[model samples]
Target: MALYQQVTGLEPHPKSDGDFTGLNREDGLVIGFQRVDGYPAPRWPDHRSPTASHLLQGQRGPGGSRGRLLELGAGKPDHQPHELARARVLTDPAGHPFCIVRG
Candidate 1:
């Protein structure tokens, strides 16, 4: 939640309960997380292994900026896809992949 708060610049929803955290804004998009025991972190570009699930991204604030994401601990994958040349591919503190693209 701490990382999420920093990156998104949004507060944890008041309704968030134990083992689950969410960010709810007036935009009507609700980002939620539910804790699972021993869940394996997905391997980016490795489809044979368990891969990423929900792909939440920033669209309206600093959270959506490549610079801001890096400032908040997001990282770039070693092998970037050619398609992302004009944009960026970053990993959250938890190694989840998210993209930042221009509108």
Candidate 2:
């Protein structure tokens, strides 16, 4: 939540249920956190690994300027190419894996 505020300069609206918490932006970006047992970080460049999931890359700027990648997960692993064409994976602070691909 602090990082989201730092990056977007906007406060996140909080919502919770049981052990799960979610921070949301009006623009539809949602960040979720939950307590769970035995979560493992996904391996890099290996989408088949446990914890991997697909994410569509959002819009790019004019002249094809690269947009910043926002990953919501556990471990903060470095970005690596996925087995699928035109996709890359990154792990979040919570060890969740995301496969970011161009939309």
Candidate 3:
């Protein structure tokens, strides 16, 4: 996880799990990781992969700056009506799935 933080410039949050870890940036970007034991890493652009199951949602901020408000999973809030569902999924070096959603 330290190596991941170093490479991605994301900070590891205290809220994490044995099967997963949460990463974040000061600019409101949040990412999650899941451990796939005994299974090969997922391939990019492959929806069949386990990594593709993960989704990250974000909202637009004031002055075009992104905010740290999240509205999905765990104890997060519900999505607002103005929040656009423009989602784009991408994979990290470890084949972990992440996404960017603009509203």
Q: For this target, which candidate reaches the highest lDDT against the unseen true structure?
A: 1
Q: Candidate 1 — worst ten consecutive residues by lDDT sum?
A: 51-60
Stretch of 10 with least lDDT, candidate 2: 58-67
The segments of candidate 1 whose C-alpha lies over 4 angstroms from its true place after superposition are: 52-60
Give the alpha carbon lDDT tens digit for every residue of 1-103 in model 1: 5656766677678888788888877877777888778877766766565644545564455466777777778777876776645556677777777676665
- Which of 1 and 3 is the better model by TM-score? 1
Clash pairs, model 2 backbone: 73-92, 73-93, 73-94, 74-92, 74-93, 74-94, 74-95, 74-96, 75-92, 75-95
Ranking by lDDT: 1, 3, 2
RMSD of each: 2.6, 5.9, 10.7
Model 1 residue pairs with clashes = none
Per-prediction backbone clash count: 0, 10, 0
Candidate 3: tens digits of C-alpha lDDT, residues 1-103: 5434543557787788899897898877876766668877776555576654554544342221122222111222233323555655444446555565666
lDDT of 2 by residue, 1-103 (tens): 3433333344455666667765776787776656566666556645565753443432342111123434322233455545456655544454455544455
What C-alpha lDDT do the candidate models reach, one value each? 0.69, 0.48, 0.52
Question: Which whole-number lDDT from 0 to 100 does residue 78 have in model 2?
Answer: 58
Range of the 10 consecutive residues with the lowest summed lDDT in candidate 3: 68-77
